[model samples]
Target: MKGTQSLERALDILFALGDDGETQTIAEIAQRISIPESSVYRLIQTLERNGLVERKGQGQIGLGLRILELAKSLNSQFRNRLKSSAAPLMEQLSEETKETVVLFVRTGTNVICVKSVAGQHLVRFVVEDGKTFPIQNGASGKAILAFETSKIINQVIHTIETDLVDDFLEELQVIREKGFSETSSEVDPGIIGIAAPIFDQANHVIASVTVAGPGDRIKDEKLSAIVPHVIKTAKRISSSLSFSTTLS
Candidate 1:
């Protein structure tokens, strides 16, 4: 924890939201942390100012963009924990599927790749560690977005094209119901992507683990076989993430 009572309370607010597993109001946050509502309000304002948290609709609060920047120096420990949990599973998945593997975290209305494992095949799709794209673009993004709160879903909806809203939302619903997502030629040409969502202990969708490769090799039948491995690896990483004490 940080020094000073006020700073400590502010950090607890972020932790409380994560533990609760969803957005909450000022009162809910105060009760969860056992602090007065007024004190929580003030601390929340300060945190909001620093880009550490965000206010969802109807006064609910959530982890902000800065909090999701796992690869940055801002929160290296948790990033280390995330990578520690995902790296091996991702590596195993790439070896099993013979395709590129990627881990993605949401940043506001976009999704960023925090880590990647290249495939064994000569013509496989390649992913860069720092790659970023709109939240609506691919299976990697959609897998994470589909599990987010409605306010977040709507927030993203407002950023993309009007015509795309219907189809995108529809696709997200399918992803939510199915617990994964798939896309072809979305991020890159002739590439197919299949992704599964990863959750923290509180059951929040923290990120997504994706398997991607060329269309010719991954065509329908092979894609079906690879899906299960992607999902299983995602679950394994999520289970490892539960060992982390806090988002910090």
Candidate 2:
């Protein structure tokens, strides 16, 4: 570790533990990463003191609960950025369509609504923030899932009804082709939903922009009419997210 700075050496120790959450003794980590045992011990002490590492057994160390806290904080920050970027547009969409507008972010195998603007109409569907659903169930979730990597898509596919897997994959392909998704009562009875994916600076799917309402009032030609507006809003939000990243 002579050529490596202290910070770099510490990071190397962390990486040496592997991404699988495997625990290792200091000597094992030092030997695996080709660093001195004394240096590894010193760095582990620093990391343990900061609550980033913990003793898993008598001699083994593993990642600590604080790492999960740090990850949650990071995820919250990204969601906050998405909310800031999508809030104004969500309001505009709700006003234009007279329907509920929602911003959803993928969390694990589910998508959670992070921001929502209720519809102006007397009879409307109210989707509360923090509502969670399977990542492949609703229009908003499908929009996010369709753009995910094949590995992740397959992982989700394996969890569903095997008989429906083919149809689900086909629907995802159509969503990718049309650049948006639409559903009627798939997740909730009597609801219509339209959504498009939002992208980050790296062109990765970060979240989705969605419009939802009572199916009776928003079906057929009416739903079709709102599709373009939802797509446009998604693009605007994606652009805003990229711009904010640039500024930061």
Candidate 3:
């Protein structure tokens, strides 16, 4: 195989392992990828030496701690960038709307809260850092679903066990057309949130910024008023990430 092909296969193996989230035998991996068991074993050995995969039991292998280390390092770097570039914008949004502002990034089929700032209100909602939520239940998730490729969006729809796929796509289309998404008492009763997508350097929606509060505090008029501010803050974060103005 060519060098690039080999590297791609290695990454594919890593992704497969992550998807399974458990140790698998060489034969199982080989069968999954339609590759020969001998080749799979050789690749597994190489990956083991590099600390990318580890043997868990007889003929079973899984991802190693090095991958976790790398993930942690990347997360730290992203958090630092967010603090330096997006934190001020989020703080400004919170102050302007007197609501909780949150930053979310896609993690597999879920969105993880990376940063948040609560408003001055005594009954404000709080989403702790590192907390994760389903991709079909919240404004931040809908913001991502609206902008991601159709392939990814379809995969999410296929995995859902409910009959709300049509409704979800209908709402996503509206959000895409309007440049933001909103949910009122969808994920949490009496709570509402508004979110706008944040683009990456390649103009892909890589994350989102959301402003949320209790429904009583975030009435229809207030939510409509803060939509522009939330969209503006998302644009600022996207700009800092080197996304083109066309995507904003």
How do the residues 1-248 of candidate 2 rate in per-residue lDDT, one tens digit apiece?
A: 45468889888887777454589899889888888899899999989999889999889999878877988899989988889889999999988999999999888789999999999999988888899999999999999999998867987998999999999999999999999999989899999899999998898998998999898999889998999999999999999988998999
Q: Flag clash pairs in model 2.
A: none
TM-score to true structure, per model: 0.73, 0.83, 0.73
lDDT of 1 by residue, 1-248 (tens): 23598878887898898765589999988988898999998888888898888999999898888776742665567567888889989999999988999999888788988999999987878878778999888999999999999888988888878998898888898888888899999989999999999998999998999999888899878999999998999999998888655543
Q: What is the C-alpha lDDT of each candidate?
A: 0.88, 0.91, 0.87
Question: In model 3, which runs have C-alpha deviations exceeding 4 angstroms?
Answer: 1-48, 53-65, 243-248
Q: What is the lDDT of residue 58 in candidate 1?
A: 93
The best candidate by lDDT is: 2
Residue-level lDDT tens digits of model 3 in 106-198 = 887889898899887999988899999888779999898799988678879988766888887888899999999999887789989999999
Candidate 1, overall lDDT? 0.88
For candidate 3, what is the total of clashing residue pairs? 0
Question: In candidate 3, residue 121 scores what lDDT?
Answer: 95
Per-residue error for 54 in candidate 1, Å, reads 16
Candidate 1 has its poorest 10 consecutive residues by lDDT at: 70-79
Worst 10 residues of 2 by lDDT: 12-21
